[model samples]
Target: MNHHKITSDHLQKKAYVYVRQSTLGQVLHHQESTDRQYALKDKALTLGWNEKEIRTLDRDLGMSGAQSEKREDFKTLLADVSLGEVGAVLALEASRLARSNTDWHRLIELCSLTGTLILDEDGVYDPADFNDGLLLGIKGTMSAAELHFLRGRLQGGKRNKAERGELRFPLPVGLCWDEAGGIVLDPDQEVQGAVWMVFRLFQETGSAYGVAHQFAAKGLKFPKRAYGGVWDGKLIWGHLTDSRVLSILKNPAYAGVYAFGRFRCVKEILQDGQIRQRVRKMPRDSWLVEIQNHHEGYTTWNEYLANQDQLERNRTQRPENILPQAAREGLALLQGLLVCGKCGRRLTVRYQGNGGIYPIYECNWRKREGRSKRSCMFLSCPPLDQAVAERVLAAVSPEQLQLALAAQDELLARDGSLRRQWEMRLQRAQYEADLAQRRYEQVDPDHRLVAASLEARWNKALAQVDEVRRQMEEFCRQQTRTFTEQQRQQILGLANDFPRLWRESATSAKDKKRMLRLLLEDITVERGADREVQLHVRWTGGACEDLTVTLPARIQDRLRYPAERIDEIRRLATEHTDAQIAALLNKRGQRSSRGKRFTGKMIGWIRYKHRIPAVELKRPDERTVAEVASRFGVSHGVVYYWIDRNILPARQQAANRPHWITLTDAKARELQDWVQSSKRIAKRSLKRQSA
Candidate 1:
C-alpha cells in the first residue's frame, strides 16, 4: 500500500470509509466483505489519520452502490468530499464508492478539486495528480462495466432457469414449492379449500367483487402465505378483498402454468428528481417464458383463459371492450344486451319519470361524441323489456330455467362457513404446541435458557390454539340459521316452475338479468315508427329471430278518439249532415270511447279533424264512382282506372278517400264506347268470345 500521496493537509481533514452491499442477503451472509470495508478504518489510522478524524459511513451497509439515491451515507460522503471536508475517501474498492459512472466520475472530479486522496485495499492515489486521476477514471469505468456485466449474468441465469421452469419465486397463496423442488398445490387442505372457493365463486358469479362479497357475507377468512420474517411459510388468515380475489383469478400459477418475466424493473425519477428502481407488470403477451402443466394446480389453462375474458368484460374501466357488464339493479331488463341499430353502439339506460321509475333505452353515442344536441333515440323501456322478457320466458318450458342463488350459503364444497379451515387451523396449532412441549420436556433443566425458550414457544402455541378455537366459536355463533331440507325441496319445486319463481317478489332484478343472459346473447333494437320498435334477438344457441313490438302511446295519444270512430265519422260525413250523423249514432247506441253520448258538436269536430265534407255537395251531372260505373255498364275498377289516368274528369278530397265523377250523357256514352271497344275491358270477355 502506497501512502506517498497522503500529505499533512489530507491527514488533517476527516477520512470517510464508504461501505455498502447490493442487497440485504449479501449483508447477512457476506460478513467478510463488510469486515473488509470496516477494516479500512485501521488503514486510515495507519495512514497517519487519528481515530477521531476517521469517520465510518457504514449506515449504507445493506444498500446498493449502483446509485446514491437511497444511501444516506453515500450522499453524505459526496457532500463532505465536495466541501473539502473529506481529506480521504476510503473504501474496499472504487465500486464501493459508486457503480454508476456518472456518480463515480462526479466524485472523482470533486476529489480532484478538493485535493483529496482516494484510498482502497489496492493502495492510495492523489486525485489531483494527472497519472493517478487517469487511473481513477479507468477504475471507475471498469467498476461500472463490472456492475453491468454482473447484473446481466445474474439476470441471464434467472431467465434461463425460468425458461426451463426451474426458477423459484414467491408462489401465490394457493401454491408452494415442495422439498423436491417442484411446484405443487399448498399441502394445507384449508388453504386449498379457500383458494378453490374463490375460483368457484368467481365462476358462478362472473364477478370478482361477487367472490369477495361472498367471503365477507359468510364471515369467512381467506388464506395468505407469509413470505419473510418469523411468519415465513406460515398461513395468514385475513379478510378477502376484491383486489385479492382478482390476483388469485389472474395468477397463472393457480392454473398450473409456470410464468416468468411478468414484471420488468424500471428506474423512475421521483418528484425530487431522485432516481429509484421499481417494478411494472408486463402484459401476458409480453411475458418472457411460459410453461403450461408444470404441476398440479387448482385450475386448468383453458379455464384460466375463460376467467380472464370474464374479468375483462367485468372490469368497469375497459372502454375498448363493450361486452356486457355484470348484472346490476335496474328496471332496464335489457341493460347491457341492447345495442343501437342505427349508430352500432351500446345503448345506455336513462330513467326520467317520477322517482326515476320509468326507464328509457337511449343511444347517447352521438351526444357523447358532441355530434348531436340530444340523444339519437329514447325508446321507452317498459314495452321493450316486457316484450322480450315474455318471449324469452315462453321460448323454453318452466323446466329449462333453474333459478340459483348468487352465492352458495355454504362455501368450499358445502364445508359450512369454513368449518374445515378452522378445524385444520386448530389442528396445526395443537401440533405445534405438542411439539414445543416435547422439546421443552426433552431439554435438561441445567440449560435454563434453552428450556425456558422452548417452554415459552409451547405456551405461545397453546394460546394460539385457544384463539383459533374462540374465533371458530364466534363464527359459529354468528351463523343463526341453517339451510334446511324442506327449504331445499321448495327451491327444487320452484326450479320446476321457473316462471312463477322468476316472477316472485324475492327475485332481484340483477338475478333476473343473469337469468336472461344465460338464454339470450344480445338484442339489437331499431327504433321504427313512433308507436313500434323492431327487435333483433340473438339467442345463445346461435338462433336469430326478429320481432316487432307495439309501444305504449303517449298521454295525449291515449286520450284521443279511436281509429274506428274516426273512420265511421269520415264515412257518414260524405252524404249526411252533422245533425243527421249524431241522430244516427244515437240510434245505433254508439258512444265515444270515454262513454260520452254522441252530439252534433262532437260530430262537427270529428268532421273537421278528418277533413270530411258534409252532404257530398255535387252538381246534378256528377255522380259517385258506383254511379259512374253503372252508367258506363263497366266495373268500378274500370271507372277508378279512368279516374287515376285523368281520362274521366273526377274530384278527390284526399288520397284513398271518395272521389266524385262528373258524368254528362255525352261523357258516359264515350266511356261505354271504350268498354265495348277494348278486349281487356270486361272480365268475361275471353270466356264469352270463346263460347
Candidate 2:
C-alpha cells in the first residue's frame, strides 16, 4: 500500500528533502523539530530512490515558510521539483514546505503533473491519484489556517503584557534595570550628573545643538551603555553628537515613563517595483502604550513636554503653523515672528542696498504662487525694528534688576557645573585605579602570566588618573579669578540704575530674537493707510496690543518735493525769476527734500514736475524777434538779418530759451524807415509802396 502509486519511471528520478523553521529563535531552541525534518532523508531513500540520489535542502533553515519571495533555497527546491528531477518529496509533514495556501497548492499541482510521490510520517502517496490529491488539498488549507491562529495568539500575549507596563526592554542612559528586576537610576554619579546637566542646558539654550555646544565647551564626555556584545553592560564615553542629543531629548524613558510603539515601520513599494520599510515617528497621542511616573525621572512630565515644544520652535523652513523658527544670525529682529494679516502667511525678509545694509520685510505669497500680481505689503527695517524695540524696552524695563541678578547667578552656576564634571571624572578614575591595584595585589608573583597582566592593567589605570589630574589643573589655570564678595555687591548695586541690557552691544541680534519669541506669540501686520502699517502683537498669554507705525515713503515719493513745498515755490514763481527764487529760498533757510540748497535748476525741475509757469521777466522795451519784425513793418527774416548784423540788441534766456530784442520809439521809427528803405523787405511788405 505504501508504494501503490510509485512506478518504475518515477524511481529513475532523484528524491528531495526540505527543512525549515519559522524564526531564528525557534531554530536554536527546537531541536526535535529539526531532527524530525532531517530524518526525512531516510524516508526519501526508502521511497524507491537510491541513497546517493537523495538531496537535502538545509539552507532554508531558520527562515519562515510563509512566503517563497525571500526564501532562496526553497526556490531551488521548486525549480528541481517542477523539472521532474524529483522521484519523491519528503518532509515530516507537507505543511513544513509552506504555511501559505497559495504556495502549498502550487507545489501539489507541480507534483501531480510530474507524477511524483509524496512521503510523510502518515504514508507514501502519489499526487497523481485523485484520492491522494483531495487529501493533500485538505492538509494545505489546514496549514495556512493554523499559521493565522498561532500569529493572533502570540500578538495578543504581547499586547496584554505591554498594557500592564511589565514588558521588559532596554532602558536609556540615565536609567537601568536593577538586579531586583525594577527600574532604577544609574549608580554612576558622573553619568547621572552629565545627564541632568544636559536637561538643564537645553532649558537654558532652548536648542539641541546648543546643548551639544555646551558639552563641547565644557570638554565633557557623554556615556552610552552597550548591549548584546563582548562589551555589553559597560559604559562607553565619547563625543556627544547633535543626533545623540535629539535622541536623548525624544526618549520618554528619561522622563520616567514607560512608552511603547512611539515609532512604527511602514512597508511601501518603490517606483522600481521593490518593497522597503520606512520608520515613521508617531505622535504622543498615537503611541500604543504609555505609563507615566513609572520610574524616577531627570525632569518632570511637564518639563519634558515643554522641551519638545522648544525643539519644535527651533526648526526652520517648516512653512506650516504659527510656530516661530529658531533664532539664528541675521539683523531681522522679527525674523520668524511676523505673520501677514492680509494673506495670513509668514512674511519673508530680503536684504538690499550696498553690502546688504538694508533689510525689508514683505509678504509675496500670492505673487509667488501666481495667484496675484501684487505683494501684500513691505516695510523697511529701521523704522519697524525701532518701533518693536521701543515696545520691548518698555515692557522689560521693570525687570532689569531681577534679570541682572539672575544673569550673575547663572554665570556662576555655569562655571560650577564644569568644575563638578571634571571632579567627578577624576574621582571615577581614582576608583578605577584603586580597583586595579587591589586586583594586582591579590595576584601571586609566582604566577607570572596572570600577575604580569594585572600589573600592566594597574599601571594603565594610574596613568589615566594622572592624565585627568593634569587636565583639571589646566582647566583651573584658564579660569578667571573669582571676584570678592564686596566687588560682587558693588556690581550688583548698578543693576537697578543700569540701562536696558537688551539694547546694549553685549546682546546679539540672535539673543534679542530669542527673547522676543519667548514674550510674543506672533506679530500680525497688515497694510493700513498710505505709507502706514498696523502691527497686532499677540503676547504669550493671549494678550494683544495694536501698534500703528508709519513706514518711510517709497524712493520715488521721498525724493520728490512735498505738495506744500511745491505750492510755496509756485506762489514764488509768479513774482521771481529762477535765480531770484533760488536766492529767496536760500534766504528763508528752505532746503530741498534731499537736504541740499536749492538752485535755479532745482526750481526749474520743481516747475516741470508741477507744470507751473515761470515768471515773465522780460522788459516791455525788450521785445521778442516776432514783435520787433511787426513793429519795423518787415518779416522775421529781415529782423533776424538786422540782429545778425548787430543792428538789433537781442538777449536769450540761456541757449534753449527764446531770444528777446531791445526796441525803443526812436529806434523803432529808425528801424521802420530802414525797413522801408531796405530793398529786401520792400517786395514782401504790404505796407511798403506796393504801387
Candidate 3:
C-alpha cells in the first residue's frame, strides 16, 4: 500500500513526534515551521495510530537541539524508543529532532535495535533494516551539517554588521536611537540628568558606592529603562544601587563609543547532565568592534578609560595587584593604604580605649588565616599619622595660596546663595501678605460675614511675613557675627600657617583622608630598632619617599645611662662606699638614666664595671698605721711597735677616725736613731736565738 515499513506490532505501539527550534527568536518569527512539526500528530493518526497512541513532545520547541541533554523532550523520545515502546518517531525534518550527529545517530541506533520506524517530510523507513539504517544515518549526518552551515552563515552576517558598527541591540539606559537611524542621548531630561549626575558624583567621590550613597542621602532616585510588560520603553525610577552605578560608569557607550562583542555567551555542562549558557564580559581590548564618536555621550573616550582605571584601583581588597582605595570615614589617616613590610600584607586598624578614641594599626593577616603570628608589626596611630600628615602638607603647601583663594570664593558664593534664598522667602511672604490684604480690601465692610474670615486670613499672612522678616534679620545677624575681618584674614593667611588650617576642628577627618588619598598611593611601614619606624610611601605620580620617624615617648619607654652620671658615680665611689654613693645619689634626686631608682647593688655594679676601688675616707689631718707605714716606707708592725712605745706622737680625731701621727722633722730624726738601735738589738737577739 505504501513504500514505508509498517507492521501490526508498530501499529500497536505509540508514535512520538519531537519538535524544536534553535532559538526563541526563530520560534516566534517562524511559526510556519513549528506548525508543520506539530502537524505530525495528524500524520501519525493517519498511519493507523489512534489519537491515544499519538504523542507529541513540544517542550523543546523554543530550545536548541545542539545539545540533546538540554532538550528534555528529545531525551523522553529517546527513552521511549530505547524501551521498545515507540512504534514510530516523526518530525518535520530530521534536523528538528537534533542538530548533533552524536545525538542523532544515538537516537537512530536505539530505534534500530527497538525495531521502530523513523519518519520525516521525506519518507518513512524502518531503522531496524540494514538499508534503512544506512540511509537514515546519512540523513542524520546531513542534517547536522546543514545546521552548522546555517549557523555559520548567520554568524558571518552578524559579524559583518558588527564590523561596520551597524548591528542593533538593546541600548543601555540614557541612550536611544532616533528615527533617522542615529544614536542620541535619552530625550527625557530626568533620565539624562540622573546619568550625568552619576558620572559627576563618581568623579568627585571616586567610588560607585559613594555615588549611590549620595543619591540615597539626597532622596533622589535613578531611572532605568523598562524593557517589557505594559510599561515597556518607559522610565522606571528607583533607588540607585552600587552595581547600577558601576555599570553606568563602566559602559563605554556613555563615552559615545559603539562597542560590539563586549560579552559572549559561554556554554557549560552542569552536574545534572544539562547545558547552561552564561554571559561573560570580554576584556576591552578583546572586543570585536569599537567605534568612538559614533553617538552623543556624557564623557569623552579618554575620560571613560580613566574612569575604568579608577574603578580598578578602587579594589582595596586586591591591594597586592593594584593601588590602594579611596579614603573612607575613619579616625586613622592611612586606612587602606598601610601595608606591612614584613609580611607584604595589608594592615588592619583596630580602635581601642573608651569610645574608640585610640586607633592601632596591626598586621595580623597571617594570624587571621591560621598561620604564624610571629612576623607581625604593630604601630600606634597618632605619631605615624602626624608624620605622614606633615609630609603631605609640605608637599601641598605650594598650592595653599591658590587653595585658600578658591576656598574664599566658594564661601562667598555659598553665603550669597543663602542670602538670596532668604530674600526669596521674604519676598514670597510679603507678596502673600499683600495679596491677602487686597482680597480683604476688595470685600465691602457691609459683607461682615466674608470680611471677618478675610481679616483673619490677612492677619495670618502678616504674621507669616513678620516671621520671615525676623528669620532674615537673624540670619544676617548670625552671618555678621560668624566671620569677622580677623577671621577672614586668618583664613587667607592659611598659606603661611597651613598647620593651623590642617589641625582646625572644623576640618573633618574624612576631608583630611580624602586629601591624603589624592597624593598617596600606598604606605609600607616596617618597625626599626629603638622605637623607630620606617615608612616607604608611594606617591600618585610614581615617586617614592622613605621616612624614618621616632615613636612618641611613653611612660614605659626604655632609656640609656648618661655618661656624666656614670663619671659622677665613679668619682663618688672612691670616697663613698656603694651604699653611701647610692644614698647620696638618691638624696640628690638623681635617677638611673634608664628612669629607674638606683640601689646599693646597682652602684656596686657600676663601680665594678668602671674599675674604681672603694677607699675609706679619714679626717683631713688624720691617718692610720697603714697610711704612716706607706708614707714612711716601713712595715705596719714597726709602726704599731713605735706607736705602742710612744716614739711618735699620735692622736685620734674621733673613735671611728684613724690615729693621727704628727711626725715632725725632730721626731723624724729621733725615730731614725731608734730604728737603728732597734735593728742592732734585733741582730743580737737573733744571734742569741740561733745559739
TM-score of each: 0.60, 0.63, 0.63
Candidate 1 vs candidate 3: which has greater TM-score?
Answer: 3
**Candidate 1 local lDDT, 517-622, one digit each (tens):** 8888788888788677899999986779998999877877766888887888888887887778899999999886467888888888888877877776667767
Residue-pair clashes per candidate: 0, 0, 0
For residues 194-278, write the lDDT of model 3, one tens digit per residue. 9989999998998999999999999999988888889999887899999998899889999999999999999897898667789
Residue 445 lDDT in candidate 1 = 96
Worst 10 residues of 3 by lDDT: 553-562
Q: List where candidate 2 sits over 4 angstroms from the true fold.
A: 1-18, 29-32, 35-58, 65-70, 74-141, 272-275, 342-381, 396-499, 559-691
Task: Score each candidate by Cα lDDT.
Answer: 0.83, 0.83, 0.82
What is the lDDT, from 0 to 100, of the residue 235 in candidate 1?
84
In model 3, pairs of residues that clash are none
Clashing pairs in 1: none
User: lDDT by residue for model 2 over 546-633, one digit each (tens)?
Assistant: 9999987788888977788888889999998787889999999988888899899999988997899988878876788788766656
